[model samples]
Target: MRYLFPTGKGYQRKWLGQDVLSGVVIAAVSIPISMGYAQIAGLPAVYGLYGSLLPVILFALLSTSPQFIFGVDAAPAAMIGGVLGGMGIAMGSAEAERVVPVLTFYVGVWLLLFALLRAGRVLRFVSTSVMGGFISGICCTIILMQLPKLMGGTAGTGELPELVRHLAGVQVHPLSLGLGAAALVILLAAKRLRPKFPMAIVVMGLGALATVLFDLPGHGVACLGAVEPGLPALHLPDWSAVSLTEGLGNSLPVAVVIMAETLLAESSFAMRDGYEIRDSQELLAFAAANLGAGMVGCCPVNGSVSRSSMNVQYRGKTQAVSLVAAAGMAAVLLWGSGLIRLLPVPVLTAIVISALLGAVEFDMAHRLLRADRKELAIFLAAFLGVLVLGTIYGVVIGVLLSFVDVIRRASQPSRELLGVISGQPGFYPLGRMSQAHPLEGVALYRFSGGLFFANIDRFQKDVENCVKPGIRAVIVDASGIVSVDLTSAERLVLLYRRLKEQGVRLYLTEHIGQVNDELRRFGAGELIEEGAVRRTLYAALEDCGAAEGEVKQWIPEEMRHAVPELLRQTQELEWAYGEEAQSKLDAMTGQVLQTLEETKPEQREQELEFLLERGRWQGVIDRDAILQHLEEHLAELSRLLERSEDAVLLELEQERERVTEALRRQHPEIASYLAAHREELEQRFQRKYPEAARHIHELRQRLHQLPEDETKEQR
Candidate 1:
């Protein structure tokens, strides 16, 4: 009950005026839009009005978000219209009226079932691409469906192509077409001029006035004739005319569309408004609203994104705005029936078309084209699927595409080839740091996603890609791994044994909390040595005989005071498992310190490089000292680059150009690989420095012509 009736603890008396005004404005907006959506759903305009009234009231009472408004949304309405249209039911017929409530009831039942089963979590599997595709497809289908009316004729049946064919053959009504065009232009202009303007009200008022003044109805314009309204009756669905089985089957698609659209809107609003709404709670609210709509003999309701946006714009403080909107809708139901009848059908269709213009996602297509081709394919497939097979089939295709994408992502989780940067605190991916290197004879790999049964072999292959014969040890950075299933554990066991057979030891570090227990249960201790699972990455490196260096040698005596004592302590300890290595490390540090004192300042850098090389060969050097030296080298390079036209820089640039030309001529494979991945480089650079990306492209173009210019001169 608490979940159903959200608390109004933060409600302020100061906000009542804003809330009431917003409610009235929202009510004014939703009335015409909802009625238009109802006409799209093959029901009477009164149903759209009734849907706005009671469903809005019920949902506002039961909603988790205080600002969210529920009513006739275009996507679900179009879906219902498409489904019923396919059933050969005539619009506004008694049979169509009967089917709507039954379908609404079935949709309500499905929403309730989803809420009870807590199936909203399944929504996560439906990616943004899928939803975007589904919505865009529905928008196109709705636009296509409404075109006949927009042209001043009866709505056509069948798929988009067939409808287009029918539209080609059908005679166009000149007067109605002009009226629709005028209304579309006015509505669009009003929206552009004042985005917050009560567009539907102004448009409907103008159309009604124009009908009266210009005698539009007498000129062959089809007005919404004789709307009988005064609030819908509360009653259970009469299942005698419609089969429950068929109704439920058809309602499934409608329910899916409603749930998807509602949750998407709800989540978006919640994020935008700085509040949290549980998905399960949202489903329950939807269930209650639709069930209320069904009881009132109206079409199913959903969270209206347009109305919600208005609610936010109007600064609606609480659910009171929805109730106020409901009040306005109720007033219209009793006294405004005549006004609705005065509205031209073409004008109403224009309203629908104008509203749908917002839903058609060209921007989404552009973004996907820039970011991901695979998702773009899915979007196009879902879009074309709808144009050919209808909304239900399109949704099915979109969902399937989303699932396939999920599988593709999981089965090929990105891996990081990790290495230590000279002065960095922790290990980073080698792909990110060019100057970093792995511990000698040790390969560190980090899988950047969850480990599961479906991706076990993928994990194995990723590990193998980083392995080479000379690698004496392999350390996996398990920091990113949150969970591990049994199959993945078994695969890891196999990888351990395989590496063992190759005389390479496998070590695991940064096991996520509780995953350590999971590893042990999988006999990880038996597969590797008892002490192989180290607490830290550096400890693992030392355990594998990779970190061989005295800590004191890495720190110059003067700068030792600036270095944190904890880092010094960490570097001093050779291995994690026992204290035995510490005594040996202390003795080594003493010997290195004695050698460093005998060395002069000028030869100190050279001596450190010698130690680093020796460590790489026979395994022991001051890793801290090598890191400090690498930092100095990086600083020196930065200074050199800052000189802009230093002789050294000029020579390096010339040599680089020579090497690039040589590679282009002699190693086309390498050149081709670079060319193929150039876009990837550009994308990364664009993300990091958007302003520089264009300049970089210009520079590359100029550089590419250098060889051509030389060739032209020679010729």
Candidate 2:
């Protein structure tokens, strides 16, 4: 449906008048500028008009951005002429005319292929600094190339040094030099005073009138004489004459620069106007427009940022403005050729130079220099590449630098030692937060990027450092780790074993499902033992023996009466366990009665208010049943551990111990029973399974070492 339909689905009929007016205004503004750019591309001025006509219409109909006006922009035009000129082809030569259209056609083919491949996504890697440098370089080159014409001398070809040497040898014509000075002053004044004025059109009209009236040619003033006008004859490029290899080689940079400029304009305008641009669709638009340009005898076309800005500032609606602009160009082609031929060459040079002033963009360069040194280096490399080398090679160098930057960032991701704040639930990087408190005897380490081969060694070293003295446990906060490659996973397995051998338990906490699966595949559960994967950071902290703040048992106001009834039912259940359980319940209830009598009547009611207070209450349970359940569960887990291949057996065993303790809290009688038989069970289990019995004994000792205040608080 998107392919079948064009953009601007919300077009209104009332906007037609404004669209037409803006189109005519843009046409007036773009005509002189486009012709000037055509001169930059080493083509006859009429070719600029020809390039702007069909290409503008095609891009308007095809592009997702309604405000984007496609035509010859300074960067690609300068690039085309510079690259061809660097190959020793003179500007406006017959050979250049024959080769340029073929080169443009290849650019079109490349853009279409790029759209098909969805390669627009790669633009993300091209940093803004690199782009700024490339553009600044192009601006410098264009300004240098125009200097000879501005001084009434023939334009120089070759690199900057060669151009500079050639300029030093040329004799400046006084008449042409004076005319160029006047045109530049008028152009700058008009832009500074009134940006909305058609400065190019006004300058062109006055220059042509003055040249004819003053007989400027007789005075040594250079003029573009006898331009043949009219729409170019539509035809496909001659395949037999086209040099496929040379054409492809030259067109690659032009195609890349065009897409970069066009997409940047598309995105900038779309963002300001509150709309979304389909990048792939915009690339398709570029392909179609360049193909149209190739069909005409002209250089390639791309979105012009300056004219597009005018289109928006003038409040153009829909593609109608572009259609109207193209019609304006058509009118010029049909009747304005004679006027174009009469214009002075210096005036056109002045117009091109003035237009390119915006491209220098010093503010952006300064920002890059201040913000990041690496990005600034990329900017300079691109800039110097174009200035010292050529635009094509400059862009290539810039892109390569950008890729290196991306790899450097990925290979050295952030590693943090995390700590929790006093009352905050989430963890933070330790020293970064002033109020954050580190978990005692435990280290929470976080890796803030994908675990891949390039950085896996660094990841291992960082983890090994966490096993410092006094740190008994290490919890890897895997919340930010989105991906884990095979190499990194293997490193993790080895790191776990190393930590285990040093008596420092390692745990992975709060990761997505994929990391969990990867851990299992890497034998995290079996090789590192089952207790390694924890559902939450808090649970891992608890297992590591980190002290928590006070916890209160909550009962809602409406459910307060039900607590007494629950307590009564527990008393009856204790009798089912025979005399031992019954006797313990009898003593607990008797203590509660004695406390109630000792308290004043007023305070006794408040004490009985369970919802409003926090305390431990004795409850009844069958001790034998719970003990029997624990023994059965452990026996089954032991069998499964022996039979299973590389499973998290220790984790399962630890989970069993945790669950048994929770059961003890529920059945206080089971607490007594376990306390009485723990030593006997450990000694017996040690004879059968020494390793497993040692882990169980360690767990019991840790539980015993917990502060009595915390034990009562837990109860």
Candidate 3:
């Protein structure tokens, strides 16, 4: 089977008997409904035979789904029929019927085009909410469309509202009505009471029997009359200018709608535990089916879920079963159409209604009852769209909702602060009951989403809300803060300085390497500081005055035992960043400039140690390179005016404070060096910020001319 249907390698040989039995059962189940669906589609009963053939075999040959069955069915075709008919290609008029096959041909061509374009994967883009709504909408339409046929109208017009109105106009065709009612009753009974009996076959046999026994046509019964027996002659569809162009215009919407419905079914079924299909291959196989339908005088065909499910349940195991079914159907079209004609139209309608009932999926509605209301609304919207407007409108609305939902979710990611438990060592959300308590004086806050511009402000506000009155240490848990934008870095820096002002400590725990790397570039590396951060909340808690051994012992016994596992992750992060991943003590000396910029005095030692560890493992971060990155980030920030003094003034104040602290750290000897080598430092600073350098040059010259002692006195 893998070779016949190789997901990665292409098709292989697999007799898998269930496939064959499935084909036979589905063929038996589908044959009657397929014919009836053809009538509902206003296509010839023989066209129904054309519609039922070959598509399933092709789908099996190319699809990833192990159990998908493709054949003629009611819902999509019914919708297509009504849509096309409304546009004037209606049945009853021989001219219109001629146009039908040609319209189908055009639709097939369009679907083939879709498959060629690889549009199958579009299924995943649709949200579950939209699909729930849209499918319900389609189901509602199917149930409504069946109403008039059950009551007693010719399956004419193929339009729901019109069919009801048309039924009101026609005197009840009693023979047709009785047979439809009987077929409906029997098929429903077979389905509910006797699951093993083939409902399609049972209803069909009874329908044929009743027609023969009652001598039905003598009364006002609508039968398919005398079906012309023989293979439909291989005739090219007249795509002459007027009809071809008109067909193209009208059929495209039908093709798109039908194909979408088929893909939706295929995707849904594929997602189930047992059987899944290759979506890309489905498109091609469906294309071939469409081309085949057009090659014969058939209306468009699609995968039939009910019949396929039945076939599998009946133990079908091979594509040959579909082939066998197609062959049987071909024989019927050749010699049995006339004999089958005596089978009352109501009987056919009953078969169709029974099959379509299975498609309604009330289970979907039950799921809605269990899900969130917003999701329920999406499902209902699709349901209502189909019921009120029709299947076509319903799916379009579904597609739109799906797109909106995806954008909404990704754009608005949730955030939370994670805190390390006092005795547990490992981190959990500070808000969650499992680990609700904050470190005694330390605030361990976890940011759950990526730090992007869209979410940065909310993140800042949440952190501020936590930093109320007497918080001593503020731990920023960056494990959840996976990705970052430069703006996010600037916002982070503002928080870092804010905590510093309250005389609180800021520790970054579990800093994702990617985000930490971005922070490093944005001058946040200096602001957030090194050594202040830990990979695990346990380690961070230990640093923040919690006794390391006691905390370790307190870890919920399950996790307390996994200390080594957690340590491995920490080691991996430290290994990735060399001198940059510095410890407080190791960060001193040659990295004195970095130490000077450290956001906290405590982590300065830890950061230097981290740097030493980094140097030991990897190597040094070039001092010039680090400075260049920081200067560039600063340059970028300077250009972004706060828009107004009040807009982000606190953030601005925080930045100003960090800069002040860094500059204030210059040693007396370094200060003396700055005065003695003012020109060299000035040139280097100018090279980094030429415009600022020009402004500072005059001040330096004025200071030098005035005498350094006078400048020192003014300071």
Each candidate: RMSD to true structure?
A: 20.6, 14.9, 12.9
Best-to-worst TM-score order: 3, 1, 2
**Model 2 agreement with the true structure over 1-715: per-residue lDDT tens digits:** 5552275577788988768867876786566567767777888777888988998888888788878788876667877887777778788888777777888889999999889988777665676677777667766776777778888886665568977997898799887888888888887787778765666667777888998899888888887755576678888876554567878888888898788756754664575579877889889989999999989978899877666755665568777888899998888788876765677888877876776565465677788778977777777888888788875577578778889888888888888898767655566788699887677788889977777888989878887888888999888887778777778788787887888889998887666656655655665534223456554565566555666442111223342244433333222223222334334434434444456556666565454333112222212222222332233234343343332211223333444466457645644444454444445544645786777556555655655675877544433
Cα lDDT of model 3 by residue, 1-715, tens digit: 5424443243335544544444555555565567667766667665677677655545555665555567776655675567556776556455545656676677778877887787766767877666656654554555555556555664434335654566567666565666678777887777788765556666666767877888876776656646566665556676662355666787887777777777776566555436666665667677677666766766677776566555544445545557667767677777676676676666666666565565554677677678766677777776677666665676677788887766565457766665555544455775666745665666667666677777777777877777867677776767667778888888777787777778776676666666666777776776434445555565556656654456665445565335344333224334235445433223433354344354365454355335434532111112222222223233232233312222222233333344334433522223333233334434656786788656444543554475556544533
Off by over 4 Å in 1: 1-9, 12-45, 66-68, 72-103, 155-159, 162-170, 237-257, 268-275, 304-321, 382-388, 421-425, 453-458, 465-470, 550-715
Q: By summed lDDT, which 10 consecutive residues of candidate 1 come out lowest?
A: 616-625
lDDT of 1 by residue, 149-260 (tens): 8888766555788778878876789989988898889877876787666676677778889988998888888887565768788999898867878989989878887777
What lDDT is reached at residue 452 by model 1?
86
What's the TM-score of each model vs. the native? 0.69, 0.68, 0.71
Error (Å) of candidate 1 at residue 398 is 3.8
lDDT values for all models = 0.69, 0.69, 0.59
> Model 2's lDDT to the true fold?
0.69
- Candidate 1 local Cα displacement, residue 629, angstroms: 45
